[model samples]
Target: MSATRSAPVFAINHMVTPALRPQAFFQLARSLGLQDVEIRNDLAGNAIVDGTPAADIRAQAAETGVKIATINALQRFNEWTPEREKEAIELADYARDAGAAALVLVPVNDGTGRQDGERQNNLRKALTALLPVLNERGLKGFVEPLGFEICSLRSKREAVEAIEAIGGQDTFRIVHDTFHHHLAGEPELFPQWTGLVHISGVTDVAVSIGDMRDSHRVLVNAQDRLGNIAQIRKLLAEGYTGLFSFEPFAEEVHQLENPAAALSQSIVLIKSQLQA
Candidate 1:
């Protein structure tokens, strides 16, 4: 596909540099001329998981001139329960105090609760329950539909429908992940409702799409099998004006001796392709 549009802005996810401190990660983003980033709750010895105060996170972002686009996720969010509600409230409060604009809502991916009507009902229930918490904190809920076969929410269409059912159009938006979009086999871009776009590539030619896992995710390049460029171009052309956060989960990315340099190369590759 020939894309004549200007390159989209890129953001760095903490997954791309899990070993770095939040301060260091923010600096790396700034060094790359990027102003946005996504912090995660899963990284051990990291900010959120390490008990770092929200004020400190806010201070760090201010010091480095970086915006905390979101707190990477609240897991298994589709299963509505008192425990999940508590977690959502706490995470939302933390995100607001930490100056993050949103929280990512990830669904259960363990193969349970995925029955057709059951999944939609659970999604709507969760969104209904979480709406007030997010609204009170003035934050957006970025619902990210995981593409795994076992994932409770695999299709963006289902996610969007659930969001609409809950009347959450104002407080929620979907995450259009290139990797997940390919795996879900969904054709619609839904750019109007996409608040964020995650860009990752799968370059392993031998791995079947059904067998692809997070360990196989890598940065976009010539070897990308997920059509990151085409998806990005389509989203951009169709009115998705949001950050494309890099979320490579492969150990190779984490083990890089110079992650900033490696990430810069990937950014260059993506930009070249988008502006081609």
Candidate 2:
């Protein structure tokens, strides 16, 4: 957008259209002129959960020429246990076999395991256990801290500290989601440690910040109240060269008759703002 800087690269997330199949999702990414995408395992009847083979997903990526950025996510990852370990192994193996470069690790968000010293220890424990699994598969773990009040992990600083304490500086990185970043009211930016950026905007004037949820997350536009453009500018200025994947969770966006056109407009608006 600047005379000296190129525009940030944008990627599509499967959440944009959970109705589409994996192959169609890849096709959608290619149609958007994006080669990178974040796929989800939570979608009903989808991969990883529905038993879709990793080889099939890899073939889809190759055919559509879309790079699988990550599998979103291994839920409650910080509450490490034997069950979590098993799930982690399966997901990490799926990520590796699917040609994805990273796995998203979402911490417990159910208002439990968040005590002062307890949360840090739990975080370190999970990281310590996951380091080897990720290392074995040669995959990066993108630790995403949710911004909800009930979330066990709400601070990127804490996640970073845990990562450093466990000596996982290289094995793990953070996901700087614009929505979560704003919700958490975090002012710090770790551009160097960021591996992915999820972008979504909440424009409803009636909803208070505390009341905002994933259902309110919509595509970024001029009416966005999330300061998405400002966040992007800062990240870019600070040398964050990761993909900005659209991750709108609003049902309105998912129901759009032409999401590709809507996403294209959003991209244009973001680019124009950066240029300005």
Candidate 3:
């Protein structure tokens, strides 16, 4: 249980404050003494989704000394279609322009896409189509499989297999999301194939995994029932030398008036646990 000097790198996602503007978000990362950060394309009023200029985002990163670890996603990425292709092209363009290192790829979670053995076929097709988009942008695709029962892609093993099937191993990687992993109840950890790890904790003792939702997500602490510290320990032990980005989606977290202070506290808590 001893902490190593090589504790996983910490990063924060904009979901920590979905309402925070670009520069303000970057400054919050800095205030927490974090150099790595992830931006989102899903926040309704925010720049990336709201059509804010990429140069403006790049400038904000430069000014704040915070590196853009990733853009939080191209949603439902596994269910490829003409519209999905267009969305991928546009989002990849933005990621490239913004100097973000990678794009998070979230598969469809609506409980319908992966039925009757069509799941693997859909996954391979998506990866095949996405390979060139990411390669052309010199960006990495982080395929994140959700753990929900209805999610099209639930297993990291399945994601890795599909990535290999499409020869996307060189340009794509898996996002080892802690919350999803707990829900998936998988026993293995694939550190080598992981590009990023999204960390969040759920403390609602009354909720079952089947009923858990993003609104239940919150920063990891002693109250965490999801085993964040142990899961992180397993990843690091498995040779995962990537960014551990905080990605709490609770509305209460997003509504925090002093997000910097809150994040700083969470950072200290995780660090202390890692060292224990």
Candidate 4:
């Protein structure tokens, strides 16, 4: 077997809409020396061409030489009924044809009065219903546990349990988000089940973890990066061989003069810290 590399591969979501085109996105990643990218389908104007012909996305990826590592998300999948489930299946097909390796699934946050047992049962049902579609399409489902109080799954531990219960680990994996991990008060080594890790920093003056919000998320080197370095180091030490994608959703980062430069700098900082 080949020796494992310590340097983490990096990618960025299409968050800086007006500033970066798909071509420019690839060029920037190439300049920064990255080989993979995760495209966010919700970014205004620069949304990954999902509903359009897959050939368009294929051409862009081919022209840019950047493989589509994963598609940003298929939200609220856990609560999806048959109609919604069918739609998600179609989306999975689209992702595969677009040359994506996986689809990220975010649990539903619908404020229902279901008990904890009901919630877990719903999650299990959803996974059982969707796993066949994902497996058939040769696509992996990256289940991301959101940390917001209202969000259903708040940690990779919960996601792992659900995956184990649903028996989808063969076709589903976890996505560890630094921002979510901090907000959820989850440990860094929780990345053991991770297939993809999202890197973002959180800044808040609150004394406790519950006070942090997703809006506080910024680039990796921001002030609230308490365990960013150590967490990534631990993941590396544990033999994680996946891409670390930048997923800052803050308005400030979206308005930056050169988002790619900021991302490049963040990658360099992460590399230096990890090497040390």
lDDT of each: 0.93, 0.94, 0.89, 0.76
Ranking by lDDT: 2, 1, 3, 4
Q: On residues 74-169, what C-alpha lDDT tens digit does candidate 1 reach at each position? A: 999999999999999999999999999999999999999999899999999999998999999999999999889999999999999988888999
- Kindly provide the TM-score of model 3 when superposed on the true structure, using C-alpha atoms: 0.96
The digit string of per-residue lDDT tens for model 2 on 131-223 reads: 999999999999999999999999999999999999999999999999999999989988888899999999999999999999999999999
TM agreement with the true structure for every prediction: 0.97, 0.97, 0.96, 0.91
Badly placed stretches (over 4 Å) of model 3 are 1-5
Report the C-alpha lDDT of model 3 over 27-57, residue by residue, as the tens digit. Answer: 8888777899999988897888788999999
Name the lDDT value of residue 84 in candidate 3: 100
* Candidate 2, run of 10 with poorest lDDT: 1-10
For residues 83-159, what per-residue lDDT tens digits would candidate 4 score against the true structure? 87877877787788888899998887655624688778877888888898899889999988877777777757767
Better of 2 and 4 by lDDT: 2
Kindly give the number of clashing pairs for every candidate.
0, 0, 1, 0
Predicted structure 4: clash tally: 0
What is the Å distance of residue 56 in model 3 from its true position? Answer: 0.9
* Model 4 bad stretches (over 4 Å): 1-4, 16-19, 49-51, 188-190, 204-208
